[model samples]
Target: MSLSVSAVPPLLPAASYEYRTVRPVHHGHMGEPRTDVLAAEEPLEISLVYGPEEARRRRTLAVTMRTPGDDAALAAGFLLTEGIIQHKAELRAVVPCPDVTKAEERGNVIRAELVPGIVFDEARLERHFYTSSSCGVCGKTSIEAVQAASCPVLPAPAPLLPAALVHELPQRLRAAQAVFDQTGGLHAAALFRPAGELLLTCEDVGRHNAVDKLVGHALLRDWLPLHALVLLVSGRASFELVQKAAVAGLPVLAAVGAPSSLAVQAAEQFGLTLLGFVRDNRFNIYTHPERITG
Candidate 1:
């Protein structure tokens, strides 16, 4: 479903960026096309407000590059995945930075302020080191730290209908990708019920953020214990994406592309039913195959 946001001023001045791609023209042939389109990435600063003062205790948290919608959920999901704030109640609100220029005017920065009595574990966040759209686990303090903090997969009986649902996810996800159809430059993540209904779907320039938005939406709607839903992505499964799915209590994850070894390992450790190359009528089961049924 398309999200409707109240009219706001332009997040960035009108500007265009050039995007290039090569496409197959015919059998054994390819061609490069130079194209230009309006740039979409914008900085969203998240700030937290806490306290009996309720008016005070304002602080800047993280700046992110996003498509300028679902700011609140994006902030919440980022905080949850980063292990910043433990629960949704800790986050009072998310708003644009008052001093955007003072913070960072780039298209990839946002501020998040927190509520009082809700002290974030700066140590953990620093340890995680906010990752960008293109890289995950790049700036972490230690591999062991991630492994140590890594959550073990939930051990539940694999679903009897999981495999068939996994196979159906890619086409469902593609059918729901309205934003991607328009931009052709975005990634998507979706949550599907065991019976094949889409609970929520979100798209973004970054795959991680897309998943975050979906999780954040679930959190806002108080849909914890995500075991009943299967999480699907439009690209290769990454470690961070898998981590987000696990954190949200999703037992199964399916991707239309390859699964990075680290991601597969994470899924195995977390006991998440992992499927990759989920196109056509077949899919590759990486970790748990028992959950999928005929």
Candidate 2:
């Protein structure tokens, strides 16, 4: 039987109503001033639960203030992106707080169980807390520090990305941004063809989670080695995002915003090309410019 999940509320923004004044419509012509409803952003908290026993022993791992929907997927994707849990086998399950009888009283917390062989340590868990899209991984102050925990490098393949396809990406991305249109409070990550064909896109209050969901979807499909395609993010590039892209074997990572110094370093070290400021008809290539051509 399924456990109740009242705590899992709406994860995305929904329209709300408010009063507003309209243009000159003479009091009698259009009646009184108009009022309308508009959607606003929703904030959600992502927590972790773990214990050796069944009762009196659940601890919160990390709380990600995020959009509420996709809670299960968010937790799973976070673990994957953070390199917390490797393969699906390493996870027994990703579920809502089991204390259903009093979920409302306890707040919205989720539990992710690791397989017997996979144990989470305090130091390993500490890394997750330090994460933020702006500036995380402070201790990885040097290049060598990044490589020590890096995933295997993926080789580059000359992909045949058609210019015509690239032109269609932004529109497709816009169509899928249901939440962004409402709240305008989130970032998006999309995977598309090297030739510019769109594949999938995900949006979230947090830029990192959006990318994680995009990459996690690919991971679930065993579609790593994304040499034939490219990744585009709606915001600035960060080292954490770069790390997730590398782990997924995505050869090129492009963002519509600026690139952080650490992101450039991580991309170069992992054999991935990083691009930023991907707007208008131009983009800045941080590394491996060979991938783009006239």
Best by TM-score: 1
Query: Model 1, 153-189: lDDT tens per residue?
Result: 5658745564656677788888777655546777788
Which candidate wins on lDDT? 1
TM-score of 1: 0.76
Q: Please, what are the lDDT tens digits per residue for candidate 2 over residues 184-223?
A: 6667888776756567777776788787767656554556
Off by over 4 Å in 1: 1-39, 48-60, 99-113, 129-152
Q: Provide TM-scores for the models.
A: 0.76, 0.75
Clashes of each: 19, 11
